[model samples]
Target: MKVLLKWLQDFVDIEDNPAQIAEKLTMVGLETEEVIYTKELFKNVVVGKILKIENHPSSDKLKICEVSVGTDTVKIVCGAPNVEENRYVVVALPGAELQGNKIEKVNIRGVESCGMLCSEKDLGLAVHSEGIILLENSYTLGKPIYEEVYKDLDDVLFVINITPNRGDCLSHLGIARELSAVFGKSLKKIISKGPKLIGQTKEFKVIIEDPNLCRRYTGKLVKNVVIKPSPDYIKVRLSLCGMRPINNIVDITNYVMLGYGQPLHAFDYDLITNNTIIVRKAKKNERMVTLDGKERVLDEKDLVIADTDRIIALAGVMGGANSEVNANTKNILIESAFFDPVSVRKTAKKLGLSSEASYRFERGVDIENTPIACEIAGNMMQNFADGQAVCGVLDTYPLPYEERIIKFRPSKCEGYLGTKLPAEEMEKRLENLKFGITKKRFEWDI
Candidate 1:
């Protein structure tokens, strides 16, 4: 799991640096594999504007561009088809290194190219791209690319090695919670209410066929959503966390999942046959094509999310291509749910389909976070996609989570740890973790 330092700051105010935080997390069983300082990799890379574009005299495929990087102007040879005059682009100046390749004053086809025009792939921000990254007019010229993406050029990324049992720590909030506990700090609370509903709409229905397979399912509708590129901050954070940005709708779901550790899915509302969602077991030999364009066959033991006519998603694994959100998508239905760990694991293994959602589902997610995550995604859609959320949430929760209380003795706990811990300190730690405590004469109820 890749955790951004700035993202963690949303939940806790820690005064430790990256190395110190890594050590502290390591002491608490969350091992940090690597710490990436983005500033070092983006050294000397700045925003530049294209002043002139001229076809290379010696080569037809290459064009010579006069780019203004703030105060200085330099000539660069580029071959990307999307290059245009007056557009802001990423420029790697002399002495800059990209993926270990150095940019320098070199002649390309007899033309002196003083710097290099960079694509997202060249800067290691994306795995593939056809053209150089085109920045919006909001970016300042000659500013470091890192400064535009992150508040501080020194934004750090922690590549954490999460064990199977620690699935709860897969997100920024989860990590922040651990940091708060380890450092004896309070975890900050965030408000996640969606836009005020215009009153309940009878547009959709949700059903749960079995309580054992699916514990809870929550959904919200956002109408008239504009499908467009996400804001710079959302795109940058997703990229920094190793996810490719698709669109505002999809990115918002992924963003909420990353921030809260609860995976969400969006279905194009027009594609839902009956405006209904049914969480139930699949029939034997039923097949559906997923977003990846591969057909998967399932049996009765497999769980799925279906509409009246057909399956829309392989439950907890992946959404179907039939209900996929696209450039023309206007109405979106967001799904946030919890499935049985064993059921999700079996279906994912049999179909050889594992996703970020499946990964979290198979291990388990906070059952109570389903609705909260849905609200967060809905609010993001409202703010970013020009969407208006419908008032009520369609929720089917047959099996509600029951709180567990474990009784313990302070002396026994101290004996297990082989330390001298007072009961008052023990109660303080448990309170910091948000556990209900009831003190008794001889023992404590937690």
Candidate 2:
């Protein structure tokens, strides 16, 4: 799992550098495999505004742009059709390096070009881009791109070696929880005060066949969604965290999954047959095409999420292509569920398919995070995709999660660790970890 330092700071207030935090995490058993400094990729890149544009003396397509970088002004030769005076843009100065190509003062069409203007593709922020990246007037003129314009890029990435047993640490929220416990800080909560729902949602229904295989399923209907590229902040964070930003709906789901440690799926509501979602065992020889465009043969032991006519998703592994969100999709059904790890692991291994969602499912995700994740996704969908939430959530929680209580004796724990610690100290530590404690005569129920 790759944990961004800035993202971690959102949950816990820490003043330590990357190396210091890495050492602390390593000491606490969340082994930090590698620490990467991301600002190196964005070094020397600053925001600049075009002062003026003049026709090049030697070329028809080339134009000379006088750009102001706060303290200095430099002339750059650009050939983009969108270049105009007073437009804020990304500037890669002469000493900067972008995508391994170093920028240097060069002569273009007999004019000395001091630096290069950058596009989204040039900065590794997007797969394709047509013109230079434009900045809003809110950005400071001479600020480094990593410092303000794209702060997510000016970060340290920690490659953590998470054990299979620690499935709780697979996401940013989980890691933040751990750090908060370790540092004795409070974990900041994410609140989603979304758009008001009209009434009880009648658009879709959920049915779970076996409560043993699936613990809980929660869904929200978002309507009138516009499919487009996500905002710069969302896309940049996704890219930095190793997820390709797709359309707005899909990216929102992926972002919430990474943030909450809960896997989520968005299905095209218009494609769901009979407006029903049935979670049950797969029939023998059942075949379906997944989102990756590959047909897979299923067995009776495999768990599946089906509509009235056919399977729409492979339960916790992957979604079917038939219900995928597309450019024309207007409404979406966002799914958040907790599937049994054994069932998900078996199916994913047999099908030779693995995804970011499946990886968390196979190890085990938080059952209590189902509705919270749906709420977060819905809030983001409204904020990013121009989507509206249909009043109520469709939830079928056959087996509700129950908190586990363990009897803990402070004396026994101290003896096991060979440390002399007071019972008050032990309670303080457990409280920091968010463990509920019930005081007893000689022992505690945690």
Candidate 3:
């Protein structure tokens, strides 16, 4: 699991250097594999403003343009369809190295181009971009692209080696919680207030047919959404953390999963039949197409989220393509549910459709986080996708987890760690991890 340093700082006061923090975390069993300094990746790349643009004389597909690199205006050859004048773009000067590919001045179709205009893909800022990315006017010309585009690029990526049992550390918030205990810092909580719905009405009905497999399921209907590209900040963080941003709705779900350690799924509401969601075992010979465009045959052992007509998603795994959120999708059904870890793992492994959501589901999400995750996604749907969140959530938690209090002895702490830990110290550690501690005569109820 990769943890971004800046994201960590959002939760704790990380005054120690990344290497020091990594060392501390490693000693505590959260081993850090690598601490990458992102700023050192780019060199000799500057923000350039396009001075003029015209068709290349030698080739119809190519265009010749003059760009100001803050110091000098150089003629360059470009071919991006969105290349426009007065827009600031990343320009690779001669002798620049982009992902080990040497960029040098060369002539393209008789045009003497001094440098190359770059896209987000060229800068390694995104998986793919349609054309050259236009920078905001705040970016000054003749400045290094690294300095302007990545103003807060002083980021450190902490590649943590998470054990299979430590599924909670798979997210940024989980790691931050750990750091809060280690560093005595407060874990920042994400507070998303409920939105005033459109007439406080919804259109979907959810039923949990098999509560044994699905512990908790929270679904919400967000209507009139515009699926578009996510903001640059979201895209940049996702790209740096090894996620390919697809669209606003999907990206928001991915973001929440990364931040909260809770996996979320979004479905096109209009595609669901009878406006209903059912969580149950798949019927025999039932087949559903995933977002990857492949048909996956399901077995009776596999749990699935289905509408009245057909399966909409493999429960805790991949969503069906017919119900996937896309550009044309105007309404969405956001799902945040906790599935049985064993059942989810079996289904994901059997179908060969492992996703980030499946990975967390197979491990297990915090059972209490289902509704919180739903609200977070619903808020994002409103903020980023221009959607109106329905007033209430469709929570189908037929069997909520009943808390069982466990007894703990302070002497066991010293015996297990082979250290002289006082009773107060043991209480502090348990309290930091959010265990509810109730004191009796000489024992603690946890």
Candidate 4:
């Protein structure tokens, strides 16, 4: 799991430098792959403005562009579909080096290009680059694009190799909690939005028939949501975390999932017939097309999130296309739930559909965060997506989570570790991690 240092700050005040912080994280079992300084990769790359665009006489998919490259205007050939006049983009000068590829002046299809117009892939900003990289209008034509993208001036991208057992560290908040435990720092918790949600009026019902497969299911309804691109902050966080910015409504679900270690799904409320949410095992030969546009065949063992008519989502895996949120979607149902890790893993493996949601579910999500995550996403839409969160959540947790109690003998700390530690020091670490301490005659029960 790649944790952005700035994003981690929202949960804890981590003052340590990246290397020191990385060493501490590695000591705690979350191995550090490497610390990525996103800005240091590209050399001689700067913001450029497209002065003019003309169709190439020889190639239909190509175009010739006059770009303003800070100190000078240069002619370049490009084929990006979104390339247009007066748009700012990343330009790699003749001496620029990108991904070990030495960018030099070259003639393409008879046009002598002085520089290369960059894309997300060309700049190593994203996994796949579609069109040219579009810069915001706020970016100055002469300024370096890296300075704006990595706007904290400097960001520490800690790429940690999270083991499967550490699903709790899958999110920034989870890692912050771990860091708080290791460093004995206070975990900065974000205050709940606490919006005035209307009570459940039998308008929405979430029935969990197969509680063994699904531990808990919670959902919130938000109406009049306008689907649009998320703000720059959300886009940058998601982009840096390796997610393409889709829209505000969808982005909120993704954001909170990263903030908390819980995944939330959005459904087009209008398509949910009879206004119901059903958590049950799939019927024999159940077929549905997921958001990926691929048709998947399900069986009786697969858990599903269904409405009055048909399956709306393959629970804990992906949402169905028929009930997906889109531009015309005005009302949405936000879903946050805890699925049986084994069931989710089996279903995901059968369908060959592995996603971030499935990854977390297959490990485990704190069941207590179900409704909390839903409420967070709902309130975020009201603030960022121009929507009103319909009060109350339709929560159906058939099998509640049982609280765990562990016995710890701080006096024997030296036996577990090579170093001797005092009981007060050990208790402080647990207290900082929010573990409840009950004093016993001999040891502490937490």
Candidate 5:
């Protein structure tokens, strides 16, 4: 699992650098396989503002821009189509080195270009179709762009080589809980309460026809959403966490998935045929085009999210394009529940559609976190998409699983560590991690 240091800081305040934290975490059991430092890659890039832009006297397709690097202004020849005046752009000055390349005063056509303007692609920051990044007004000119861009940007991705038995550690919260235990700190989380429905959710019928394959299926409807691109902060956070922002609706689902480790799906309410959602085995001749626009044929072993008319999503894998949220979608049905991991895994492998959501779901997310994740996504949807709260939640389950209980003796812990730990210290560590303990036994019944 890749645990970003910024995300880790949200849960615990550790007074150590990423490398030191990685080493400490390694000593405890969550082995750190690699530590990536992005700051080192961007050494001398600075924010620059385009003061003026004029057509290159020599080349029609080129533009000569006077850019301000805070201390001084310099002329640069740029060939990009989107260079404009009064925009903040990244500038690599002459003699500056970055990513093993040195920027030098060079002649382009007949002009002596002293520096080069950068695009997201050029800086290896993001993949955008635009010419150059029109940085937000917040960036101070001449400041080291990397520091401004990557501040609070210590991401120590712990490639935790977890054993198969530790399926619980597959999630961020689960990992945080474990670390809290290891470091004797507290783990806290903010869970949302699902949107208040204006009407009963039973009006929109839901059925789990294949209970064996779909262990649980919980859904909630939200209305009056304005589907637009997420805010800049939301987009950046998603990118920092290694996900591309699609739209507000899709981004909310992905954001909640990353924060809480539970996969979620949002379907356009109007596109769902007959206001029905059914969980069932796929038919032999069933075919679906997923959101990525790939046509996939289904097998009998595959579990699907279908309506009376057609399959809307590949269960626990991906949503179909036909029922996906679009710019015009106003009402949506958010799905957050558990699918049989074995079945999801088998179907994903068979269909060759293994997304991050599917990968985590197939491995097994914390069942207890389903509602919390759903709540977080719902709240984000309302806030980011201008979505309205609906009254009721549609929750269907075959059985309720109880919390896990494990016992650890104080003496046993000390013996295993081969270090002396007082009973008070051991209890404090376990309690900090949310483990409830009696004087005689240690138990976590949440």
Candidate 6:
């Protein structure tokens, strides 16, 4: 699991350096497999804005442009299809080095080129066809693009090797809780309680035919949503966290999952057949094409969410393209549920579809935190996407899992550590890790 430092800050406040934290986390059970320093990848790239663009005197495909790189304006020769005047872009100045390759002044077709403009492909970011990404106008001109794009560029990414028993550490919040225990601090959670509903949600129906596969399924309908690209800040955060922003609704779900470790799915309400949701085992020859446009055949052991006509989503794995939120969608159904770990794993493996949500569900999550996470997603959708909750929730939970209780003995802990810990010290550490005490026993309600 790759863990970024910025994501870690959401749970606990650690003043230690990256190396120190990595060393500490390694010494404990969670071993750090690798440490990636992304800032060093782009050393001397800076932000620049196009001041003027003119047709090349000699070549029909080439263009002459004047770009401002903070201190002064320089004339550059370019042939990109999307070069426009007065657009902010990334500029790699002369004498600058990227990925150890030194950029130098050059002459192109009798035109003196002092610097070169960059694209996502040129910067080795990713494979893309969009003419150099038009940066936000708010970014200051001539500022180092790497620094502006990654405020915490020096942050370290720790690839943690987690064991099957350590499912709780799969999420940012879960890692935070472990860090709090190791550092003797309290972990905070960004949890919301309730949201406003503009209409009654009872207009739709929710049915769970197989309680063994789905433990609990909760859904809320939101109306009048605007589907647009996410803001720059949101896009940057998602990029840094290794996700590409899709749209407002999808981005909100990704943000909530990264923040709280709970997976959420948004479905277009109008596209749902018969305005009903059915959670049950897949039919003998059920088939669906996921959002990624890959067709998958399902077995009887697989679990799926079906409308009256066809299967709309692979439960706990991915949603179908037919019910996906689109630009014309005015209403959405936000799904937050707990699927049996065994069922999710079996289905995902059978369909050859293992997503971030399925990976977490297969391991296990804090089942009790489902409602709080749903509320967080709902609030973000309403505030960021201009969406409104339009109904009561549709919750179907036939059976709830019992909370886990662990018993700890002070002498046993000290003996296991091969050191004698004071009784007060043991109690303090356990309390700091969010364990409640009753009589001489402590329990963790996971």
TM-scores for all candidates?
0.91, 0.87, 0.93, 0.90, 0.86, 0.87
Per-residue lDDT tens digits of candidate 5, residues 1-446? 66666676676766567777777767767787878764544555788999998888889999999999998999999999988789888898886765467888999998989888987555544445468777766588888775685454334455666665566666666677777777666776554344332223555777888777777677777889998777655565566556777778888887777767888999999998899988999999789999989999998888999999999999889999999888789898889988899998898887777898788877787766676666667777888888885655666766666766676677777789899988888767768777677565452222
Which of the two, 4 or 5, has more lDDT?
4
Pairs with steric clashes in candidate 1: none
Q: Candidate 1 — what's its lDDT?
A: 0.87
State how far residue 300 of model 4 sits from its true place (Å): 1.1
Q: What is the lDDT of residue 175 in candidate 3?
A: 91
Residue 276 alpha-carbon offset, candidate 3, angstroms: 0.5
Better of 2 and 3 by TM-score: 3
Question: Candidate 3 versus the native: TM-score?
Answer: 0.93
C-alpha displacement of 421 in model 3, angstroms? 2.5
- Each prediction's RMSD to truth: 2.8, 3.5, 2.6, 3.0, 3.6, 3.6
* Candidate 6 whole-model C-alpha lDDT, 0 to 1: 0.78
Name the lDDT of candidate 2: 0.87
- Reference-based lDDT, each prediction: 0.87, 0.87, 0.83, 0.84, 0.76, 0.78
Off by over 4 Å in 4: 41-43, 51-63, 79-87, 94-104, 118-139, 149-154, 193-199
The predicted structure with the larger lDDT, 5 or 6, is 6
lDDT by residue for model 3 (292-345), tens: 999998889999999998998998888899898766899988888889999989
lDDT of 4 by residue, 1-446 (tens): 87899999999988888898999999989899899875555557888899999999899999999999778899999988999788888898888887679989999999999888898667544445679877766467767666765464246788999998888889998899988888778987565454333325465877889788887778888989898767767776776677766788888898898889899999999999999888888889989999999998989999999998899999899999999998899998898888899998999998889999999999899888888888888888999989988878777767878888998777676687989888888888889878999989888889
- In angstroms, give how far residue 5 of model 3 lies from its true place: 1.4
